[model samples]
Each structure stands twice: as C-alpha cells, then as structure tokens.
Target: MGRFRPGAETDRFGIRIAASGNGVHVTLCRPGRRPCIWLHLATAGTVADKATVDDRPEIAALARRAPRLEARALECVRNDRVLFHDLDAALEPGQVLQVEGPNGCGKTSLLRILCGLSLPGAGEVYWGDAPLPEVRAEYYEALAYVGHRHGVKGELTPIENLRFHRALAGGTPDRVPGDALAHLGLEGFEDVPCRTLSEGQRRRVALARLLMTRRPLWILDEPLTALDRSGVAVVEGLIRDHARSGGMVMITTHQAIRLEGCVLGRLRLGG
Candidate 1:
C-alpha cells in the first residue's frame, strides 16, 4: 500500500487499484483511523484474501471494489426469436450504462442477465478478472437490482417493507429505513400500508432501498416507471450521487435522462 496523503486525490471513498506481477491489488483508505487495507484478487478460485464478513457497510464496501463488472458477446433467444445478439458492455466505478431501445428490444432481458437473475443464451460475464461463475456469490453481494416489479409487499408499510428488504440482504443498512422513506418523500406516509399507496409512491418506496443499502453495482429496469417530474429528478440525483461515490449504475429508460456533467454511455439494441 502506498502512503496516504491528506487532501490527496483519493477516490471519494479512497479506493485505488494497482496491478501487480501475479494479480491485482486493491486498497481502500480512510483519512487516518483504519490502516489502508491491501487485498489481492486471485487469478483463479475464491478470493483467499477476503475481509471478514462484518455488519459494517464500509467493510462490505471495501470488499466489493476490486472486481469490476463486464459482459461480453451476450446473446439471448426466446422461443426461436432472437432478442439480442452478441451484446457487449462494461461498467466501471463512477459510470453509468444506459440501455435504451424501443419496446420489445430486450432491455429488461439484458439487465436480468447482467445481474445474474437469468442466464444468457451465450456469452460470458466477468467480475474483475474472473469469470462470473467463480465469484457468483461475491458478485451478487456487491450488486443492487431493481426491476419492473416494485417488489413491495402490499401488506407491509413502507418502513416495514424496507426493513424486510434489509433483513433479507443481511448486511449493514446504509441508512435508517425511516430516513430512507423520508428522503424519498414518504415521511408522513411511512406508516401506511403499501397497498394504499399509489403506483408512483410504491415505486418510490422500492427506490428507497437504493438509499438504505450500499452496493457498488446497480442494475435497474425502467427505474423511472410511474415516477412524476420530481420523482424522476430524485432518481436522477440518486444515480449521480451513487456514481460520485464510486458506484456504477446500469439503467434502462424510455426518455433521455440528461445529467449536465455526468457522462452516460448508451447501449441501443435492435437496429
């Protein structure tokens, strides 16, 4: 590990990756409290060098950064119809990959494959320098996925629903559930059961998970669905903040999302 200089150009979270002779090394440095942690990515198999699983988001964050995500030659076929062919894409820290096309272009299908929810007809997905199969568990741990379904239980309140999500993940919560709800404009409505909330509110409730959890890679499908003007802006702000914090997001939307300073790479399917 190199020396940590104050006011240094460290990453927002002080992440630095350097390649070594046999493997790659990752270092996540904080200002002065914890020493810089040096972890190596093995050329094969599970990472022998892993931080102990703890209930702290920082520790988990450190563990997830070394491996970047990549998808290559991805092809999908459904019932003899070619959804997409030989799709290739990559997303690194502080970047966004926007998958856009007309309806029935397989935008959602590609996202599902990227997040490991479904398998591709043919292609390879890499996590860091390793094939995804070798690091499946680790990859999923570092990923956050939001699809068309709100995934909110109608019987649960916004707070309860978010709490349930956090519990299922079993990791440290980034923010209090109530705080996440409030941040998404659900302050007075937190206690109300989700069934009573409108479609937009339910979507907001689901979006709140992005605030309450920390994950390096976000794969979203129709993220702005059912959102109003302000809600769309809120979602955009979240994407910007996440990228600025050294996280990567892959999104699919119908309308163009223009972020003044953020560079968006587009993947348009079905020419």
Candidate 2:
C-alpha cells in the first residue's frame, strides 16, 4: 500500500487516504497518537491515483479543508406534479440549517435530495463544488443521516443495536455504546429490546447513534419527533456542540430549537 496526501493541509478530522493493492485506505491521525487509526470509509470501486485525486480541486479541498454543501435551483417533484421549485441553499461548517413548511410542502423531499437519498427533478447538489454523484463515497464518509423512522431493530437491545451501528461504520467510535446510551438517557434501558421502550426512549436510541458517529455533516429529518422537553434539550445540546466543533447540520423540525453558540439558518419550503 502507498500513502497519498491530497495536500499539505489536513482534513477537518485529520484524515489521510492511501491506495492499497485492492482498494483505498482511509486513516485518521490524531495529535500525539503513535499510529494512525484506520477508517472504513467506503471507496466506490477503484479510486483515482494520487495525481488524479489531487488534480480535482473539489476532492483535494474536501480532503484537506473545511467542506460545504450546496443546492442550486433544486426542484422536487412527485407523481407528475411539481412539489417545489427553484430552491437554493448552502450549508457551511459550524452552521445549522432548519427546513420548515406546511405538510406536503416537500420538506422531506428537499432533505432527501440534499442527502443524496433522492434525485432532484432539476438542478444539482454539490459537496465542495463537485456534484454529489462524482464524490459520493467521500461525501458519504463525512455524512451522518437520521430520518423519521427510528431505524432500530425491535429485537435488538439498545446496546446491541448501537454496537451493530458501530460495526457498520467499520471504524472505532469516539464513545462506547454504554456511554452513548447514558448520554441519551437510555442508561437503564440499555440491555432491553428497543421494542419495549417508550416512543421517546426509542427516539433517544436513534439519536444516540449520532454520538458514536464521527461524521462531520448531519442530515436530520424531524429529529424532535417524539421527544419531550428534556429530550428536546438534549437534541439541541448535541447540535450546539456539533456546530461548535465545526460540524454542519441540516435538520427538519416542527418545534423551534435554540443553539446558543451556533449560527442557525432556516429554509422554508413552498413559502
């Protein structure tokens, strides 16, 4: 395997990519760490050679600098009718964007398009100046998505579910499963199947995954769905800390949220 540095500058998380005989390798280097840690960032098929990676300004800058997400003239459509059109927005590091509108105004559609889950009928979504399709693997590596569904297996205990989530990431998490559960107020329910938990508790479990994920961009859809006052505060605190740490967030919520130390922006659909 040969190591390649996109540039002398470091990525937001101090990551480096190396080309191996079979695929690309991503490593995280932390200050004072003797050896870099391997990250299981998916590389779609063969990666570009060192020169190729460096040649693309978008890819190079994404690997070596702060990143931005942009949508230009996005149009969301359903059936044969258009739901919304001409939407333009940009989300920068250390900023939170809230998407709001009446029911069926395409708030969910817009979020889906921005997160690459669905395609826009018109216009383009870019991650650091490159179209999302061209840099999918890299963009996904930096993204964490939480949608309307709880996304947890009913049969799996909270701890088991969390561990499975970490396994899928293919990287060591910053926090352990138990610690994450505790932080999300799931301490006593850690070993029980999520099916037995209350709606709010289950929602907490879903949101707890954010704590273990080290991704820089969070795309959340109705993150406050079933949470109560305290739970809502927890979600707000998480967003605040993430923004303070230079992470970007795009969220959809019916309830207003306050992030004291972070810049918050809003996009209203069908307005």
Candidate 3:
C-alpha cells in the first residue's frame, strides 16, 4: 500500500488528500457519510479498487472547477466585421480543448488572443484569477506555443535549435536535445541544418520543443500540418500523454483528433 500524507488540495466535501501511485482506495465513513481515500500501489494479486466518484466522468467534470486559463465574452473582429463573439471558455487541468471551424473563421485569431499575442476586440483573457497582463511572466513560464509557421530556425541544426530552446527556458532540461530530436524521428538528421530538411522534418523540429520545454499549457495551431501519418500519430500520443499527466492543451486543427483518458471539449467559432 502507498502511504498518503496530508495535501493542500481539497474537494467539495473538504476532504484532504495526497496521492502517489496509480490505485485509489476509498473507505466510506458513517454519520456524515464522508469518504477517506488512500493512495495505493498497483502490486500483483492486490484487488484493484473499483472506480469511485473521482473516476466517474460526470464527477470528474465537476471536480475540474479551477480554471487555469479562461476567456470571458471574447470577441474578435477583423476588417471591421465581428468574427466571433460572446466566447466564454475555461481550460482546466487534464483537459484538451479543440478549437474548430471552417477557413477564415477566426480559429487562429482566437488562439492568438488566448496566447496573449493578439488581443480580442472585446472582452478579456485571464490566467487563473487575474488577467493575462498581470501574470504575464508566470503564465508564459507555463506556456508553450506552436503556430502554423514553423518556429524552427533554418540556419540551426535540430540539436542546436533544441539546445537554444532549453537555454531560453533556463532550467534543467527534462531530456537531452538529441533524445527529443530522435524521439520525433529525426535521428540521423539531428546534425543537419533545418534549412536542408524537408518541410515535414522542420515541423517535427518545432514540435520537438514541446517535449523539451515540458510546459503545462500548450497552444497549438495546425500542429499536424505537413506531417506524415506516423508523425501525426506521434503528436496525438504526445497530446494524450500530456493531458493524462494533468496538462492542458488548446489546439486548432482540421484533422480529427483521436484521444483517450482525458476530458475533451470542442469550441466552434464563427458558427
């Protein structure tokens, strides 16, 4: 059995809990009908605990009440015409939000607004409880963005680019740059300048930064563009893993995204 210490987190019932492993053991208490949860290791021959309220989809949705990113009544206008308006949304941990719409429907514009690169014509974007401007430094530290234009520097090799990215992040890297490159299927091409690589390979280089940064929030615009089937699968896996680990993602893509084991929400623009 895994031991659980007191954690700062509390649910609606004010249950204090700490977690360390895969299994959850809950003991029901009488009188007030409160429940105590125990953290358990997944050992052989141990009867796996049945799904509890925390595992139920409906309860999980209610439990995700804290917003990491929120947009309230956001309106976008280009060429003096409103593209989208009255858009209120929030991103919580372990959630993947897919922004979907037709061409010129302001999907990219919405992403830019959420990223704080572009402002909405009306309304506001907030990180946690405060507006984005007030928490720019802290928010950016947790943000990783990939746009339609591949951000890879053409003159730099994949390894060099990833190293530069790590330096900019200013922390101990989660993995070596070469390892990230190879994981993205750029094994032999790690030393070659990004300028000489194919467009798909360049896209892979930009995507590899996501692995190295390990940021909690990812804002991706057309992340699957110019990639083969295998590359697309790799990105899907990355997004799924990130969400499973309690990371949030905001992505705009025309392709259907197949994900499992996390809450997925779709926001349609210009509809």
Candidate 4:
C-alpha cells in the first residue's frame, strides 16, 4: 500500500500511487462502483531499480470533460405491444452500461434493438439524433458486438481466425498485433489450429478480438464465461480503458462485475 490520494483527479475513476512496498495494486472497476479486477504493478525491485509516478495534473484536467451521449431512445417495445416500456435513456460515449436480469427477459432483444440489428416494435432508437437505420453504416463502423458464441472459426488457427474476423468486420487482415494474443496468454498457440484448443483457450481467442477491434461501442453478452482471474483482469482493463477513451459499452452478465465511476442503468425483466 501507498499514500492514497483521494479525489485527486475528476475523470479518473481509480487512483494511481507510488508504492514503497512490494508492488502497487491497481483495481479496475466500472462506473457503477463495482470491482471488476485487480492489477499488480510490480515494484522497482523486480525488473527495474526505480520508477516514477506520472503527474496527476494532466489527469486532473480531464475532470471537467464530459462524455457525449451518441444514442437516445424515447421508448422500446416488441411485437407491436409493450414488452418493456418507458425505455427512455441516453448512452454517453465512454460510458459502461450494464444490463442485468433473468433468462429470456428481453435483455438480448433490447441490445439487438439498440444495435439496430432488430427494430423496436413501436419506439425509436437514434444515433446522435439521427434514426438508427439512417446511420446504420456509421453505427456499425463504430460498434463491436460479441454474443454467446465465441465467433471463431474452428478450422482456422488463432492468427487466421483473427484475420478472418478483421476481414469480416471490414478491417484489413492482420490488423491485430501479436501482442493481443500474448495479452490473452495465447503466446504459443497463436499459430495453432483452433479445433485443438480447449474451450477456455478458444474463448480466449475470441476475446483477443477486443484488443484488436477498436470500435467505439462494445455490445457484449456474457463475456466472462470461460475466463479465469487473469483473463477477467484483461477484459476489465479493456472496458476501463475503452470508457476512459470515450467509448461506450453495454454488457449483460449473470455474474456481478464490479465497476467504479460508471453511470449504471439497468432494465430488469419480469418486473
């Protein structure tokens, strides 16, 4: 532990400290005050002899910066009637919005509507004041979606799978660097065939796309299924950094994800 500086920076959700002990502990969290994961910054004694803390003044300057909401909706419904009503909400860039509820509660359906993959029965969804369908191309360009499936090709190698994903997403092949694979702890298996990988390893390969895709909005469904502690840390860091950089995220998970400084809005199904 080190001397804690509370409220040192406004936009900063967590604190950075220069620890005199073995290492500095950095906790990644969502804006909703939930703990996502923890990061251990090894002290200078390990790899290097000394380290310096970056000045907080620059971070403090961002305190006044507010994220702009790019999406707005008046109401949402399904099948020409109200499935879930009064869905008035605004999603700001750089915000992490979590959707929680029981099974078949329209959580996934709602996300589909938001992403314009499906249309709302009655209400409308807008992207920066324009109708979602009108800006579908622009919206898709800014969005990255991950559903229940890992979405990786079983016949392709890890690198090949990532390359295919990039191509399908209209991005150049090999756009994702090798570091992305290493970050997910998939160093040796980068060139290995996907079918031979374990379930967890396959999931890691799918998750590796998060680092590769730089889309602004992340719509994820149950993203933490096969991840271990370190894998969870990687995802948490990705979410934190995405929000900090003015990107938006919408995630639905049965397990609790501890996040801090996030403006949490929820839609509970079945009441």
Best by TM-score: 1
Measured over all alpha carbons after superposition, the RMSD of each candidate to the real structure, in angstroms, is 8.6, 9.5, 8.8, 11.4
Question: What lDDT does each candidate get?
Answer: 0.76, 0.79, 0.77, 0.64
TM-score of 2: 0.78
lDDT of 2 by residue, 1-271 (tens): 1123533434446566565554455566643455463643355645555545544444433443456999999988899879988889999877899888999999888888988999999999999989999999878777888888768888999999999988886555768999999998887898899899988898899899998868889999998988999999999999998877668999998898888868899888876
Task: Measure candidate 2: CA RMSD.
Answer: 9.5
**Cα lDDT of model 3 by residue, 1-271, tens digit:** 0111223444322333332244332322222345554333333423223334343444344333334899999999999989999999999877899999999999999999999999899999999899998999878877889988867999999999999998887644668988898889999998989999999999999999998875779999999998899999999999998887567999999987788776899998877
By TM-score, the candidates rank as 1, 2, 3, 4
- Model 1 per-residue lDDT tens digits across residues 1-271: 1122212234444455444444445676543346474786544432223322232344335544556789989998878899998888888766788987889989998988887778899998888888888899878767888889869999999999999998876556778998998888888998999999999999999899887776778888898988898889888999987776668889999866866556578888988
Regions of model 1 farther than 4 Å from truth? 1-36, 39-65
Best by lDDT: 2
Please provide the root mean square deviation of candidate 1 (C-alpha atoms, Å): 8.6
Q: Write the per-residue lDDT of candidate 4 for residues 1-271, one digit (tens) a residue.
A: 1122322232232333333356544443333356532445554544222333323332222321233334344345565655676566667765788887778667878877887877676677776667777778767766778777768888889998887777667643224647778888889998878999988788888877877765667888888887887777778877877776556788888876766655566646547
- Compute the lDDT for candidate 3: 0.77
Pick by TM-score: 1 or 4, better one: 1
lDDT of 2 at 248: 90
